[model samples]
Target: MSTNTTDIFTIRAAPGTDIWRKPPTTNICNAPTAIPPSTRSTGPLTSFLSACASFSFPWRERYDQAGILLAFRRRSESSDSGIPPKWIKTGIEFYQSQPQLSTVATDTWSDWSVTPLLSSLPGAETEQWTTILVEKSEDEHGKSIWVYRVVVDEQTGEEKSRTALREICWVYGLDGEWDLEVVAMAARPEKEVKDGEEKELVVKVRGWEVKWEE
Candidate 1:
């Protein structure tokens, strides 16, 4: 299938739920909280998304996130049906009370898994410019996997260094992985907001690409 990419799109989250998987207690997978109501779209299959932006979260909650969402729907399912059964989001996440590159994937009834892209101490934070990518590829075992990566430039002393950043992968079946799409930007609030409550989270996204199989 041909690949289609869209121009830069800015996504705003008004505060509520964020795309996450905190089972047994809260499962708001299908509909992500804190996402701007105006930017949600039901479109073509999208498999890859690369975005650069400055992120900010209203409250420093553990699961709070603002990043690229790789939403996947089953071939036999309706595009308008609730939310995609399987999906993945990777970017800056507040984990263990620290800002770390985090990726979360969900499957079947909001079952989710968290993968920390960075292993060192004091993970990256909300900076001026950051690069994040979520792509589907085959692992060394030749299995279909989703790769999450981050890149940042750091300066030590008088020398500047380009870091590869952090990377992590997860395996998923490719049998029914056709209907895919990317949410250019998405956010989830710490908790559900009240009727009159306004939780605003803005993420500036620049340069993005979307690709999928026909």
Candidate 2:
């Protein structure tokens, strides 16, 4: 079976140097909210930290108008044989009925799901995570910037056995104001299975950087 994780490719940043947008949420396991000492999760911090140790972090931001935080989470809740498993994206700005991000005055918006890719095994040593940040340049026409990153661990800062596509913006317009432009986005794939292994996909994003696998 043909696969890409083992296939190496080179990726380089596009021309025109620019600044980078830091990821909104860092401590992925923890919710990005001002939880008072009294309202904080009573669970052991070690447990939360342990969970994050195996999975990649997520993105979190608040709606400008509603002041609701959109906490984008990744991890599988349940799985059926031969399936990739199911995940969810829950937060203040997401509507259960419409399931769209709450953008300023916009009520209906689309939500994203983060997938888990920890190597499944019996008593497999605790899996590791990798994290990375991709800097994207905005088009003069104000098109959505493309964000690409490699998932890695917190301690080692190593990427996951697989790579994923992520994009985040403070606001797409002037002074945190979102322009809301829709364009054909270059897909950052998570469930890519170029080869036959029931596992991760590692492929180069053209002119970006070399793809790595664990």
Candidate 3:
């Protein structure tokens, strides 16, 4: 495959809450079909890019469809009326299915795109523990865009994967993945992340972003 520098860019950050605002270090996982890189206009491209940022549309529509949701219900039974009990954790079959969440109001989860039309969005400074968002839009020129945010964590060591230093190390583990590919968008000031107990903060993590047109 040929490489195109025009659409690729990257953002860098130090640590702690300032990574947002930073542009993402984007590398096209795969180019779209029918459209060549040389033909699209920049204005449309910028608008499209911003729209992509607005909505978390999937980069790959095929084999990218999946969602994990968790729900909680009170154990208390009804007095007179009978309401059927809902699963303590009724949601996606993968991650949410593994852990039973009866006591918790929110179900913890990990998943990728539900459709090839969807792509995986990553969180700010991630190693695992990424945040995810969906790309919801009607069509181009119609106002609406696509974007995504996903995170990951080291389930075994349970290490905090949000640290830049640790993230750098994590990238190496991915074999020069630049590792930031999944979560480049959220590193922006427009986004923030929740770590253990610390509050989320706006960040300046930009340099590259992903955008596509049809």
Candidate 4:
């Protein structure tokens, strides 16, 4: 029998008050830190990353996000238990009744921040499609950092706008090293039951790539 099956699977987060999977660390989101040099040799490296798609959510629901997410757990931690020590998800999210660029990072706990998108047009039911780029870089101090960028592209794959986002340390573990995983993530925070009709929320992601460092 052919082992291959022509089936599709989706990874979905449960609907909640918010999409955040952890508790708040503080009032202010902590700045990202640098990856330890020792870990660099073994290289939990990632690059040339991208994701693109269009999605629809209940207008102004304040509970939907779809894009690229990178999650890391300390190398010292057990692979069998608990959430990753740090993670970030970047994409279009509904907030304050407007769609904006949202990136939520968690270390020990979670913190969310938003940047207004240049693509957000007035009085639109949904915003335009987007591309997210994730890459690794070094600071003047020679520390390793992760850079996130939001790009707007034309239908022909021509560049329209590219906005460089804040860079954070590629590592989150203080005691030792970290194990990293990158994925396409989507979430819906609210459940809508309109007279027993299930409102199935969905998001799409495409054109993703991951190139390991040499």
For all candidates in order, the CA lDDT equals 0.50, 0.22, 0.21, 0.50
Q: When superposed on Cα atoms, how far off is each prediction in RMSD? A: 6.2, 20.0, 21.2, 8.4
Writing each residue's lDDT as its tens digit, candidate 3 over 1-214 gives 1112223222222122111011143211121111222322222111222211111211111111111111112323322222112211111111221211111111122112221112223422222122223222443445332333333332442323221110001111122111011123211111233355233222221112233344
Could you give the candidate ranking by lDDT, starting with the highest? 4, 1, 2, 3
Total clashing pairs in model 2 = 20
Residue-wise C-alpha lDDT for candidate 2, range 1-214, written one tens digit per residue: 1111222232221212111121352111121221122211212111121011111112111110011122211223112222111111221121221212212111223334333323322222221223222233356565332332344553564555434344444323323211111100111122232354323211121111211121
**Model 4: per-residue Cα lDDT over 1-214, one tens digit each:** 0011112223344444233555333322121211111111122523322233333333345545666566666556636334455667676777777777777766556667787765566763564556666555565765444545545444565556556665666342234655565555666666663455334445544444444544
Better of 1 and 3 by lDDT: 1
Q: Candidate 1: where is the Cα deviation over 4 Å?
A: 1-9, 30-62, 109-126, 152-177, 192-198
The alpha-carbon lDDT assigned to residue 175 of candidate 1 equals 60
Better of 2 and 3 by TM-score: 2
Write down the lDDT that model 3 would get.
0.21
TM-score of 1: 0.63
On TM-score, the stronger of 1 and 4 is: 4
The segments of candidate 3 whose C-alpha lies over 4 angstroms from its true place after superposition are 1-12, 15-126, 129-136, 139-142, 146-209
- Can you tell me which runs of candidate 2 are displaced by over 4 Å? 1-110, 115-125, 132-136, 140-145, 151-164, 167-170, 173-214
